[model samples]
Target: MDEVEVVVAHSERATLRVGDVFLKVDTDQARIDVEVEVMTLAPVPTPEVLWRKPPVLALAAVPGTTLGSLGGPSTGSPAAWAAAGATIRKLHDAPLPPLRGRSGRSIAALTAELDDECELLVTNGLLPADLVTRNRQIAETALRPWTPAFTHGDLQIAHVFVEGDEVTGIIDWSEAGQGDALSDLATFTLGHEEHLDDVLAGYGTDVDLDVIHAWWSLRSLLAIRWLNEHGFDPFAPGCEVDVLRSRM
Candidate 1:
């Protein structure tokens, strides 16, 4: 294999370097098996408050290159959806380390966080109070029967790599945690409904689609509420709210 070049770097966690090996960890997971070539790590500046730290290394092969991010269209399409579902199922089946943090699966806790975020946004004059309330209701109503499982909190098309009908690799383990499995499914389903059945079929088990749908709805509301309060349009490309709304 040829050496992959370092094309992009994200913070201090990971860098996309040239000549790096892309080994497949099962059918879902993939990682850089080599040390980064550069020493200086940069910080990502953003106003969005996060629940956890991002990954250390985030890299992918160049498009049309030997080790590109697999193949197929980028996001929310049928091919991308199938790949995402397959990858997530594989990840969920992997053994996980013991969780050592408070759970975010509870409606009250999620609502509290949403409330605080709304207050912050309103204080900054970014959104209306009524919209915040509406979003809160949506969140509370959507997240029912809170069961937790190991979830890829940031599951999306860009995070998954596909080559034809098979999933090449699943990338980005930053927001991973012990949470509701359905939430992970919902996270993907919210964007690509066409592949919902296929994705679930890939799981090879009976999963409650309603539960997944609820989780997706609640997640969408929370994300959109945050974006709206921050004075940014929630429908922009790469926007979490937009991705969620596409499902609705």
Candidate 2:
């Protein structure tokens, strides 16, 4: 009998690993719909879908280990990171997914949500007034219009898998859609600022550093409250709080 490993579990969804297979149990079928659809449309390598039973979508685990995770030291070589970057560029160049920008959200909607979160951070004393204000101002640069691309809307480093400096697969496609390319870049290099140059090198394009900086601040500010509520520590070493402090 294969031992069951609880990969991740929260109020909204959970992932379980049994042997070489991964079971993604999501309450929202719409997200599952997107995940299944985007995998077919995306040009990049993805996990093999073994089966789906409503809430439980089974996937065959892809080869290679993860690229590392947030608040943790990265183990992949510079070449591996570059390969990940190149893979991302390929995905961006692919045709848009069936769904629009990560749940069809517009820049205006995101801006409004950002402002509301900033206000809450200040009003509830969750963060220092000065810190929230400064980051909020910095976050404004990311609010402007951007060209939509096929984006891994939540392109965290851990989502990418690599083998011997080659990208094997990218996962977590529920957020994949037509969205800002820089948004994906910002998420990938959020805390790993040292790897930004390497990523951009393989990305092989010019990018707005200020906009990247803005996304860092904006993403951290919006995420702190949710993380705190969701049994995660935004204030952990090398985590969201540290990322925010770096801007100051």
| Alpha-carbon lDDT, every model | 0.48, 0.88
Query: After superposition, which runs of candidate 2 have C-alpha atoms over 4 Å from their true positions?
Result: none
**Using lDDT as the measure, which candidate wins?**
2
Each candidate: RMSD to true structure? Answer: 9.9, 1.2
Residue ranges of candidate 1 with Cα displaced over 4 Å? 1-80, 100-107, 128-130, 224-233, 237-248
TM-score of each: 0.58, 0.97
Question: Clashing pairs in model 2?
Answer: none
The best candidate by TM-score is 2
The residue-by-residue lDDT of candidate 2 on 160-185, one tens digit each, is 99999999888889988898888888
Error of 2 at 102 (Å): 2.6
After TM-score superposition, what is the CA distance of residue 175 in candidate 2 from its true location, in Å? 1.0
